[model samples]
Target: MASESSVWNTCNYSRDVTFFYNLVGKKISEEWSTQDFVVIGLGLTVCLIVVLANLMVMAAILMNRRFHFPIYYLLGNMAAADLFAGIAYVNLMLNTGPWTRMLTKEQWYIRGALIDISLTASVANLLAVAVERHQTIITMQLHSNMTKRRVVLLIVCIWVTAIIMGLVPSTFWNCECDLDDCSTVAPLYSRRFLIFWAVLNLLTFFIMVAMYARIFIYVRYQSRATSEHTSEIRHNQTVVNLMKTISMVLGAFVICWTPGLMTLLLDGLLGKASHANSFEKYCLVIAECNSLVNPIIYSLRDNEMRRTFKWILCCLCRKGADQRRQPSVKINSPLSEETLDFVQKSEDRALRKPQDSHDKDGWTEPRV
Candidate 1:
């Protein structure tokens, strides 16, 4: 009887050990994958491109006087947000280990915070841009009142609001989750946050769409009612160009942001499954790709910007054409008697009419 009892205890111990070993082995097998390398490589490549492109956009706006306007200020803010997002993604890709290796708790927290901040900032800036455009189109008088100082204030407000949005999530929910290789966090998709963002996004999208639709409708009506005036035609063309620019910006925003929002909604409501990891990663990749897309769209669509970019590249290449394009020294030549007389007459005529400094700058001295 004693021998049988001892045998039964030994059998139970052996079964428990075997079960533990098999569980560990299954985990190890699941972690191992050849495709991790490719995914990381692609992620890094995308990050590098996005960072460089966004930086270029910021630099271009800052360095060029032509781009120094309220609209471009918003664009610069957008680029800055994108630049930060790209950097954060690069950090995430570098720190993320193979599936076999779990991410540290710190990494999880940091990534969540960074993603929340970057995404909120990017989307907020887009909304701000759209609002600015709506104001310009719907209330041209209000646009005329827009000043550099006011624009700076608007940008500051956007950053503050975005930070609040990001911080709210962190305050309400745990920002870190332990997962294999990478960390996952609960993004407290506040009903308030969701409703606010959705309304903003939809408002911007619809307003721009409606404005463009109205402009096209008006143009068609004018074209059918009477012969198009050259000035009217030029005005319509300018409106079309503006619409195209806004469309590109809106389109890129929708493409990059919608997937992530959808995924977030799914996770928040239904709880994401382990099998959905790949889909989540794909959504991230798509969102990050927007940082690269914005610069390309801007450069291709804006004529002045396209020319400036070309000139900059030519200068970098040390091309002869760039050298030949330098300003002529003859610009400083002394005016002839007749030219001087003409300038004096023009000055007298200008003094006769009340003029602002802006109008004064518009006038030029007669050429020699």
Candidate 2:
């Protein structure tokens, strides 16, 4: 009973610490109920799908040399962010509900930090992609002139910003000294911080929308300007199509995350009166679904991304088949350079099957 009292003591609002009960409004036990089990089971299943889909996207971008441009690099970074979010969500699901009761304050902060990092990285990557596209399309260039080193530096800066954003809440912006400033949604976090974070992200969304709107307006003007060269018109069409695919990705992000961000903003402004708890779980679930939707959007909209996804699946299938079959036609050094050479040769042949149908980036152009 003394230990239980100590645990309750640690949850003191005056000290800005949170007990799991503060969020859930219930007592926890060593055992979970059937409802808890089912909820966790479904959540884990969804998280697994999110992880695998994003992993496939990352692998496709990494392994395909054709997808090495600034835009593709940003997309790859976005995939990495989504993959990180998936892992974060899995961690949250595993440690949430009754399990949160067992967490130390430091552990709880780490969990929230992981999620914050993922969200910030995702938003930053989207902004980077938008900027890259606007630069390329405005100049009527097929791709930006960004060097590999510059792209790498840009990506590094993005992650650094995300880390700083994620750490700010626990390290500085927390309401440890004042209960009146504490957030309702995150009991240890400052309401001011939540308000700041939400408004910043919303402004970013608006900026990106304006940028894309400008790009489309420019493209429309170009299309109507009556270019005499066939090649120029074809180039414009390709850029337009790629921009449309990226717009779809941005649209998905906005649709999924806006509600959650709005809820957080209202919680910061109105405290308990916002009734954020009633909408919090639903908002979170919708936001989590966004990661799962991105890979599908890429597959459906971008021919190269779709083909790369298929190539990755086929390689996996071949490996599984090889594991199950006898080595009747196997050569020497099956685990060495010879095996890699054979696989590379096969992939090259598959990729080069189409003739005189390449895009600006050397990918086979999609049918009209």
Give the TM-score (vs. native) of candidate 2: 0.83
C-alpha lDDT (0 to 100) for residue 140 of candidate 1: 28
Worst 10 residues of 1 by lDDT: 175-184
Candidate 1: TM-score? 0.67
Candidate 1 lDDT over residue span 1-368, tens digit each:
99888755543222221232232232223353567778888888988888888877876777555466677788889988888888888878765644323444344446656776787787677767666765665432112347889988988887787677666644543311211212121322233444444455556556655665665465556545534555344434444465567667768877787776666544443443423334777888888888888888887777555554655565567565556554653432133346545644564453223343433222221111
> TM-scores of all models?
0.67, 0.83
Off by over 4 Å in 2: 1-31, 323-361, 366-368
lDDT of 1: 0.59
Off by over 4 Å in 1: 1-32, 99-106, 139-144, 175-228, 273-275, 318-368
lDDT of 2 by residue, 133-219 (tens): 888988887678999999999999999999999899878787665556767777677889999999999999999999999999999
* Cα-based lDDT at residue 209, candidate 2: 93
Residue 315's lDDT in candidate 2:
61
Q: Give the Cα lDDT of each candidate.
A: 0.59, 0.78
